[model samples]
Target chain A: MSQRPTAAGDPVIVVDRLTKHYRVADKDPGVLGTLRHFVRRKHRVIEAVKSVSFDIAPGEIVGFLGPNGAGKTTTLKMLTGLVHPTAGSVRVAGHDPFRRAARFLEDITLVMGQKQQLIWDLPTLDSLRINAAVYRIPPAEVRPRIDRLAEMLSIGDVLAQPVRKLSLGQRMKAELLAALLHRPSIVFLDEPTLGLDVNAQTAVRAFLREYNAEVGATILLTSHYMADITALCERVLLVHDGALVYDGALADLVERFAPYREVEVELEHPVEREVLAAVAEIDTFEGRVVRWLVPRDALTQVVARALETLPVHDLRVSDPPIEQIIGRLFDGRFEGSAAPPTHPPAA
Target chain B: MRRLARLIGLFWSTAVAGEMEYRVNFALAVLSSAGGLLGALFGLSLFFGDTDRFAGWSWLQALVVLGVFTLLDGLTSTLLVPNLGRIVRHVRMGTLDFVLLKPVDAQLWLSTRDFSPWGLPDVLLGLGLVIWAGVRLSVSPTQALLALVPTVASCVILYSLWFVLATMSIWFVKIHNVTEVLKALVAAGRYPMSAYPAAYRVFFTLVVPVAFLTTVPAETFIGRGQPAWIVGSVLLALLLFAASRAFFRFALRFYTSASS
Candidate 1:
C-alpha cells in the first residue's frame, strides 16, 4: 500500500550506493616489528559505509535506525557532506555536500550528539551572533529569530549565561537553537535527544515536531530511542550489518519482525508450569504474572483454554514494543514475516 | 574585512571571558609567558657578552631578530599551536561535524577560531626593539627602506609556512607530531641566519625558511640589504601562501567527519 519510491524528485536527500573507506596503518607488537614499522608501516582499508542508498522526501522526518557501528553515523556524515564518500553519490537540496559550496551549507545543518558547536567560554547569544555573522544573516533578522527560538525553547536566560555552566538538557536546547538559526531546509539530527531527561526529551521532541510542521524542514534523524522514532517519523530505515534490511513505515518493521501479539495473564493463585506450556510458548513467568508469546490465531484459543482450565483473574493482549522488534531483527532471532504493504500505516 | 574584524573582536572577548572562568589558569598563563620572555632575553644577554658582533653584526641587530622571533613564537604557541591541537581533538571526537555544518569556510574557521590575548605583549615588545635597533643603526632612509620590505615579506612567508604545515593534519592524521617538528624549526629562527656561515644560511633560507625571520630583516636594517633577495622572498611568500590554499582544498576531499 506504501507508495515510497527509491528515488524521488521532491526528495530533499538522495543517496545512491554511497560508500566511504579509510586506510589505516597496521603494526605487529614485537620489538623487531615495531622498528620495522618505523621504516615501513602496513595499512588496511576499512569500509565504513558499504553501498548504502536511500531517498528522503521533502518535509519527511525519517528515523535512521541501526546499532552502533552499523554505518548509521557514516551514512549521516556522507549525507551532510561532513565526510567525503569513497564511492557513489549524495545530493542534498540539489547540491554536492562535500564540495561545501556556500549554497549547500546554507540549506542544511548537522547536530551531533556528544559534540557541541557553542564556544565553550562564551554565552550562547555570543556564539549565535558569530554564526549569524558567518551566515551573513542581517542583524535585524537574527535578533527576532533568536528571541522566538529562545521563547519556544524557554532558554532566554541561559543564552546570556556561559555554555559551560548550562545543564546538559539546557545545552542541547541551545545547541538546537544555534543549529536552526539559519533556518536550514534540511537538518541531519544525530541523536538530538541523547542524554536528556524525560522532560527535556519531551520538550525537544515537541519542539522538533512543531518546527518541522511549521517550516516543512526535512529531517533525517538517527537515534536508538524508539520513542524518538515513533513520535517523530512516519517512516523508518533499518540498517543492520552495514546494509539496509528494511525501509518503510515503522509498523511495517514491527509487522515484518513480530506478527504475533503477546498475551499476559495475572493469576489469583500460582498455576502449574505444564499448563502454561500447553497454553503457549511461555517466555517468562514471575510470581503473579505469566507471559507468553502466542500466534495471533492461537491467542484466542489459548486465552479461552486458560480461562476454562486454569485460574485467570485478568488478561491483557498487546503488540510487542518497537524496541523488541528491532532487537529481534538485529539479534537474528526472527526471520521476516513480511507484512502486507500498507500506505502510511500506523507505526 | 568588516566581518573578520568583528569576528576577531568577538573572539578576543570570548577568549577573555572563557579564560576568566579559570582565573588561576589565566594568571598562570600570563606569568609563564612573561617569565619565558625574560628568560630568553637573559640567555641572549649572557651569550652576547662574549662577542662584540655576532657574525659581523652588532648586539642591537641580533636583539631585533630575537624580539621578532619571540613575537612569532608567541603567535604560534598562543594561537596557531593551540588551535591545531584542538582541531585534531575535534576531528577525533566528532565535534568537527558542528564546525563543518556552520555556514563558513571550515578551514578558515578552524585556523582563526582560537586566540590568546597574552600574545599582544610580545608583538608590542618586538616592534619596540625593531625601532630601538633602527635608532642604533643610524636611521638612514636606505636602511629603513631595506628593513620594511623584507620584514613584511618575512612575516607573510613565516605565517603561510605554518599554515601549510598545519593543513597537512587534515590528510595525514598521524602527523600530530608535526607541531614538535615545526617548533624545532622555529627555534632556529631565534638566531641570526648570517651567524651560521654561507652554506648553513643558504640551507635555512631555501629549506627551512628560517632566514625569512632574522637574516633578511636584519640585513636590510643593518645597511647591507640585497634587492634581488627581497624580491625573491616576496615571491616565495606568495607562492607558499597559494600552495597552502591549494593543499587545504586538496585535503578537504579526504575529510570524512566522525559524524559522517
Candidate 2:
C-alpha cells in the first residue's frame, strides 16, 4: 500500500531507490602486512545502503529494524540529512534532507541515543534553552515549553542538574526532551532507548506513546528492543545487509514467516504423551501441561483431535513471542520468504 | 544576527553559571593562567637583563609581544581551545550527529558552544602589560591607534588558523589532541619574531603566521612597523578565513558521505 502513491494521503517521508556507498581502506593483518600496507594500501567500496525504497505516512509510528551495520542508523541519518545518499533521493517533510534548510530542520528532530547535544558541563536546562534559541523561539514561550516537556519525561529536577551528573537514563530523557523542544512535525529516534534498564526503557516508551497520541507527530524509531516496536509501531521496516527485506505491518511480518499458532494445553490428569504428540509436534511436556506447535491451517483440526482424544481441561492458542519470530527471520530460515540480496554477489 | 547573539548569550550565561558552582576550580584556573603568563615574562626579563636589544627590539618592545601572546592565549582558552576539543571529541564519539541536526550552522555551533569567563583575567592582564610597555616606550597616541589595525587582524588570523585545525577533525576522527600541537606552536608567539634566525623568521611568519599574531602589533607599538605589515596582515586574514570556511564546508560534505 505504501509503495504506491495512495489516495489515503501524501507520504511525509519518501525514499526512491536511495543508496549510500563508502570507500573504505583495507589493510592486511600483521607487522609485515602493516609494512606492506604502508607501501600499497587497498580500498573497497562499501554499499552501506542498497536501493532501499519506502514511504511513511504522516503520524505513522514505524520501527526500523535491523542488525548492526544493517543500515538502520544510516537510513535515519539519510532522512535527517546527517548522511548524504550516494545515489537516488530522499524527501522528508517536502524538502530534500541535504539542503538542511531551517524550515525543513524546524519540522524534524533526530535523537541518536549514543550521541548527546547537551552541554556536558552545564545544567541541562541551559542546553534546552540553547535549542529553543536556535529555533528562534520567543523567550516567553521557551521556559514553559521546556518545563512541560521535562515534566512529561519526569525530568523536572534532572533538568536543573548538570548533564554529566545525571545517569544514562536521566540524561537520555533530557536529550530527548531537548531534541523535541521545537515540537518538530517529524521525529527520528535512532536507538533512543539503547543501553537503558527495563524500567527506563518502559518509561521512555510510555512517554513516546503519549507524545505520539498527543501531537500525532510522525515517529520513526530504531531500537534493539522488540518490546518497543511491539508496543508502539503497528508497522515496521526490516533492513538486512543494507537492503529492505520487509516493509509491512508488524503482525504481518510474523504471520508471513511464522504462519503457526503456539497451542499450550493444560490437562486434567496425566495422559499418554503419544496421544497428544500425534496431533502436533510437542514443544514442552510437564506434569499437567503440554505445548504444541501447529500450522495455522491445521489449528482447528489439531485442537479438535486433542480435546477428543486427551484429558484436557483447558487450551490456549496464541502467537509466538515477537522476539522469537524476529529471531527466525534473521536466522536465514526465511531467506526465500523475503530474500535480502536482490542481486548476485559482486566479484 | 540577533538570533545568533541570543544563542551565544545562552551558552555563555550557562557556562558562567556552571563555572561559578566550582569556585575553587575557577579560582585555580585564573591563578594558573596568570601564573603561567607571569612565569614566562619573568624568564623573558632575565634574558633581556643581559642584552640591550633582542633582534633590535628593546626590553619593553619584547614585553609588548609577550602581552599579545598572553592576550591570544586567553582568547584561545576562553573560546577556541575548549570548543575545538569538544568538537573533536564529538566527532570521535559520534555526538556530532546532534550538532548537525540543529537548525544553526554546524560549524558555528561547534565553534561557540563554550565561554570560559574565568580566563578573562589573562586578557585584562595582557592589556595592562601592553599599556605599561606603551608608556615605557613613549608611543604617541597616533602610533597606539595605528597598532589597533594589526592587533585586530592578528586575532582574525589566529582564529582562522585554529578553525582550519578543527576542520581537519571531521575527516580524521582518531586524532584527539590536535590542539596540543597548536598550543606548542602558539608558544612561538611569546617572543619577537625578529629574535629568531632569518630562516626561522620566514617559516613562522609565512607558514604558521605567528609573526602577524604577535610581532606585527608589537612592531606597531614601537612605531617601527611598516605600512606593509598592516596591509599584509589584513590580506592574510581575509585569505585564511575564506579558505578555512571553504575547507569546513568541504570537510562536512566528506563527513556526511564517508563517515556514516
Candidate 3:
C-alpha cells in the first residue's frame, strides 16, 4: 500500500491499473425482498480488483498474498486471460492478455490449486499426451519432455496409474507436469502447493525453484501458505479489499510491517502477574508460561531486561508467524497491543 | 487440417487406451447395443404385422428409417454427447478456464476430445441394421451410395443442432434437460414424416427438419425421395452449422470463469 521502490529488471508481465468488476444480482434477505427481487431483479456490482498495478520481471517469482475474497485470484485470472479486466490494460509476454492470442496462450500457462486438467479415468500420461496434442507440440518431443519431467518430480510410476487412483500429492505433481509440458515462459500458479503434505509440499517447492532457475520462466504465484512465498519468492505483493496494499521485497515487507519479535518465557513457577506485565506487553500468561510481543526495534533491550528480572526456565525468541504479520496487515491496524481473530478462516 | 486430424486422432487413441483397461465394460457395451438394435427391429415388426404399408411405406422402408435414426444417434454418442457433458462439467466447475488458456481452439478440442470407444459397437450395429433393411427391400449398393449424400448432410445438421444446444450451456447452466427434448424429436424421425397428422408432419419436416435426418435418407434408398431434397438438406445443414458457430461465439462471451 506504500513505498515507491525504484523500478528494477526487465518486465515480462506488465499490468497497468488493472480492474475487474462483476455485476451480480442483488437478493433480499427476507421473503418480501425475495419476492421483490423476483419481480424486478436488482443488480449490484462487486469490484473484485481495482486499479492494481504491478510488473513481474523475467525469471522472477512474485508472491501474491491476500485473504479470501480479497481479489488475489481475480488478479491472477485477469493476468492469465481467463477473466478480462473491466478496465485498464495488461500485457504478458508482449501481448495483450485480453486478446488471448494463440502465441500468447502458447507462451503462458495457469495452474489453479485444486482444479484439475487431468482426465480422471485415464492414466496421467494419457492426459499429458492429450494436452500435448492440443498444444500442437510435435509428437516426438512429447515423450522426452514427459520422461524428463516425470523423473524430476519422481512421478514416472505415478503417471502410469489412472489419475483418480493417485493420492492428492501425486495428482498435483502430475497436474504441474501437464501444465508445464508446453514450457511456457510465463507461469501463473495459484496455490500450487495446496493440500499437499509436508514432504510433498517441499518436493513441489523444490521442483518449482529448479524449473524457474533452469528455464528462466517468470512465475506469479499466490498461496495461503507462507512457506511457498518464503521459499520461492524474493518479492511479495499484498492485496487487501480489492486493492494493492504493498508491493516490494519480502524482507522489506517483513521489516516494515512485522515490527515485533515474539518471546515465549517459561517460568519456574507461577509468578506474580505484575512481574511479567512490568517487563513487556504480556501476550498471554497461563500457569508457569508467559509470552510477550517485543518490538523488533528494541528486541535486544526487551529480552535483556526480561532475562535479568524474570525466572526464566525455557525461553524462545522468534520472528512473528507469517499468518500473524499478514493478518495484522489485513486488519489495517498497526497498534500491535490489540489482536485480530487468530482462528483460521473456514475452508 | 493435418494437425487438427492429428489432435483428434491422439484424443481418441488416449480415450480408447484408457477404455481398453476395462475389457468387460466394452463387452457389455457391445451386448447393450445388440439388445437395443433387436428391440428396435422387434418394434418395427410388430407395427408392420398389422399391414404391409403403414402410412404408405412398406415394413422394409420403415426399417431403413429406424436404421438411419439409430445409426446417427449412436455415432453422436461416440463424440458429441460425451463432449457436451464434459463442457457442462468444465463450465460448472470453472475448469473451463484451463480450456480457454490452451493454444488450440477451445471449441474444437472440447468437441472432439475423449470419445467413447464403447459407442463404436452401436455404430456398427446401426450400419448392419441399415444394410439388412436394404437387402430386404432389394436396394442396390448404388442406392446406398446415393443415400449417403443426404445421410452425411443429416449428420452435419444433427451435429450443428446439438452444438447449438450444448453451446447454450455457456450462457445458461443446466441444459441437460434440453437434450431429452431432442431425444423426442429424434424419435419422431423413426418413421416417415407422413405417418403423423398433416399439420404435425409439416412441422417436423420443414421447421425442425427431423424428417430430413431419417425419413429422407431412407426414402433415397427406397427410390421415393427426389435429388432436390438432398440439395435442400445440404443447404439447411450449412445454414444451421453457421448459425450454431455464431451462437457458440456469442454464448462464449458470457462465460465469466468466476470461481464462485
Best by DockQ: 2
Ranking by lDDT: 2, 3, 1
Off by over 4 Å in 3: A1-10, A26-40, A260-319, A332-347, B18-56, B135-143, B222-228, B258-260
Better of 2 and 3 by DockQ: 2
- Tens-place lDDT digits, model 2, residues B181-227: 77777788899988788999999987889999999988987899999
Clash pairs (backbone) in predicted model 2: none
lDDT of candidate 1 over A1-347, digit per residue (tens) = 44343433577777888888888788898999899889998989988777777778888889999888788888888787777789999989998988888899998988877788888766898899888887888989999999988888888888999899999999999999999999988988989989899999999989898889878899889997899999998888877767676778777566667878888999989978988788878988998799888787777898888788778899998888888888877885555465532222222
Expressed as tens digits, the lDDT of each residue in B127-232 for candidate 1 is 6767787787676877777678878887777767777777676666555687788777778888787667789888897788888766777777777778887787
- lDDT value, residue B18 of candidate 3: 66
lDDT of 2 at A89: 91
Residue B191, model 2: Cα distance from true site in angstroms: 3.1
Tens-place lDDT digits, model 2, residues A1-347: 22321324688998988899987788888998899888988889999899888888898899999888898888888899888689989999899998788899999998877777788877887777778788888889998988888778998987888789999999999988988888888999989998999999999999998888888899999999999999999888888889887777787677776778899989999888888788889999999899998888899999999888888899899998988877777776674233332221121
List the lowest-lDDT window of 10 residues for candidate 2 chain A. Answer: A338-347
RMSD of 1: 4.1
Fnat by candidate, in order: 0.68, 0.70, 0.65
How much is the lDDT of residue B201 in candidate 3? 84
